[model samples]
Target: MKTRFWLSHLRRVSPMIGLAMMVLAACAAPGREAPTTPPTPNPTLTVSGGGALQPSPVPPTAAFPAATPTLPPPPGGFGSPACENPYLPVRLGATWDYQLIHETTDTFTRSVIEVTADGFVDQDEFAAGAVRQGRWQCQDGNLIYLTPGPVAGSVFAGEMQTDVTLESNEGFYHPADLRPGQTWHQKTVFRGQSTLEGEIVVETRTEVNYACRAEDFETITVPAGTFDALRVTCEVHFTTSVAEGMTFEIEEQSTQWLARGVGMVKSVGQTEGAPPYTIELLSYRLP
Candidate 1:
């Protein structure tokens, strides 16, 4: 049941989805559940504020406040106007179709359409079965996610109900323009609550930190078409805490290719203890 439930939520692909999704899956743990493994394993995580991994058998008193960026924001205020981003043109009625291919033969298709002034609407006809949208704000060229779209996977079966809310958010989704070797940072906090038969059963808090850098530009081809794209790499760190004093930590690495006037064309990523996956653009239309 856990595997099926996690996979269902994992398929709700986001436009900038990466390690954040992995952390959300882990957030499924009941507020009192304990970590089954060491917070840090092999391949020491280099994410800032990650510190060292504690030994197994996490104590009930462990407390690790979420980490923030150690370095200052890259010159230019970390972001620019939303409309100024050539790589992610947010135009009304614009639509993008994508295909997510797992390491196995499993595949899923999702779409983002009906661009609004703040953000776009993401939909997965099969997995989510409903339209989900998030809010974004562009201030002086800085684009920020006010609130992520409603996570449909929280709709549990049976009498179990889950509600996930954003506690706080800081940082920009992407810079107005991609400059070679440019770097940025972001941090987000989420609160998850679970109920059994209308009774609150568990609650969890998750903090996600991101460190990203733009590599270089290259011409890439996908089912949609071919275009010059910029390669960006990011390292994500997750820290989840339960009221019972259990804390869980993990890391993920991902890369994305953004094309001018086309938005994200391809994405490849892997969580600390999971297989790799790829998301590619199948088709897109702009007004």
Candidate 2:
């Protein structure tokens, strides 16, 4: 009877020992995951400008600032003091010299010879021995160019040998009629014919179209002193045709500053596929 009681006690203790061994095996498993620690938060940075600490605003990763707009001059703000048309003073015997800034340095001069009912006759000479004669006129308060006629004893008289003529005329500036934001149009045509070997003949024609706008009034400085000037922007389209079945087209943009009584003080020109060039007044003489 004592042996039977001891066997029953051993059977109950064997089940408890099996459960404790299973628990120990689960805790000692090789693939079990470890507990993770929480991450710490970062503190914000503040900038001090001699005041209380304040969080700085985040800057944009990629952005550009907007351009500032230029203000226009007031009405009747700046102009030539002595002339009715301030942008162009059509005084006879007046002259101006300009420096051309391009690949090579050059000089250009324009001189007025005679005053007509409409405008004045002028001559433009370049340091490279090129010469152009033209007439400038005021039509309805707008400055215009006319097909130059023969002058009795001028350099234009020599041009008669070349058989070149101005087929059409155009106006470049209309300062009297233009207010800020106003625009105007101009068209000019030139035709020429030359004979080679007394038999071969060559004919050529050139047409230029200009769209000009009175952009704004601003103070500009150049080799000369600073001046309050009217700014004009122009888009120029030029086409040329040859009788030999060849034709081509060109486009350029230019900006000009005209001060009162000073004509063109500065000009900047840019053509497609070419470097930009500028012409600025060095000195001027006016009657």
Candidate 3:
């Protein structure tokens, strides 16, 4: 009876649970999608002294003291003006600090280092002492994660050390050309291998499916400030298979608030049988 009850509950909440986990994982290391054809590299702009182009900083507006509750999908749907993606600041030297609350409270930071001839590089540091060095690029007005690898001397989770290599660039945000009710899909696969105490090797394959939509607009207040933001909802399905024939599946729902020029100010994720998790921007420095 207990197994039957849990199964029934999972059937109803799988999508939401999957999305919650996906949002957290993706934020840490955005994966790559499988593309049928190779895409041409976008033109790179050079800055003064023949350096990489830098993003211009945008000033923040007045803050709203009152926190607005989440609202239903907006009527008539809204699209970004000029089809510009605002979720990624993309400026060199820009940084954002976030406070994540899950089983425990932790802080994380993401900083943009170099805007290369092909893409940009970011350094991600987790409170648990792990760090990820990655690259990102813009294509079709969407921000994509190109390649992500762990830095040497960076601390890793658990007793295993793992590395992530991108097979293809995966879209992380599509604020440009996004309209209310517009749905998009993404799939990513990652392979992880770890060596145990002796010489035993364990391989794990992770696959994630995301179905996201531009749902509405809302006012969210964080430690940084309050702003009117675009709300995006996603349903995610995740599967992990181990070399030992053990497979785990997860489902969740996630919501992110992207403020213009500020990026992600807040995200809420929830899964069944577990407490909800949240990440909120504490502060940020642009350019």
lDDT of 2 by residue, 1-287 (tens): 00000111111111112122223234334774211221222323333464222222432121122442444433342222222365766677789888877655678787877665455566766675655566554544455544322111111111112234455454443545345666676665555433323322334455666677777788999887798888988877666665444565667788989886677899887664455778889889886
Q: Kindly indicate the candidate among 2 and 3 with the higher TM-score.
A: 3
Per-model TM-score, in order, reads 0.64, 0.61, 0.62
RMSD to native for every prediction?
A: 12.2, 39.7, 14.0
**Arrange candidates by TM-score, highest first: which order?**
1, 3, 2
How far does residue 136 in candidate 1 sit from its true spot (Å)? 2.7
Which residue window of length 10 is worst by lDDT in model 2?
Answer: 1-10
- Tens-place lDDT per residue, model 3, 1-287, is 00000111111122222232233233334362222222232322224564423222221111222443434332221122222355666667879998878656778797887764445667767666645456555444555443321111111123333333333223343434445566676554554433333222344455666668877678899999997887888776666655444576766688888876777899888654456778899999875
Cα error, candidate 1, residue 229 (Å): 0.4
Model 1 error, position 147 (Å): 5.5
How much lDDT does each candidate structure score? 0.52, 0.51, 0.51
lDDT of 1 at 18: 28
Q: What root-mean-square deviation over C-alphas does model 2 reach?
A: 39.7
Error of 3 at 12 (Å): 26
Candidates, ranked, lDDT: 1, 2, 3
lDDT for predicted candidate 3 compared with the true structure: 0.51
lDDT of 1: 0.52
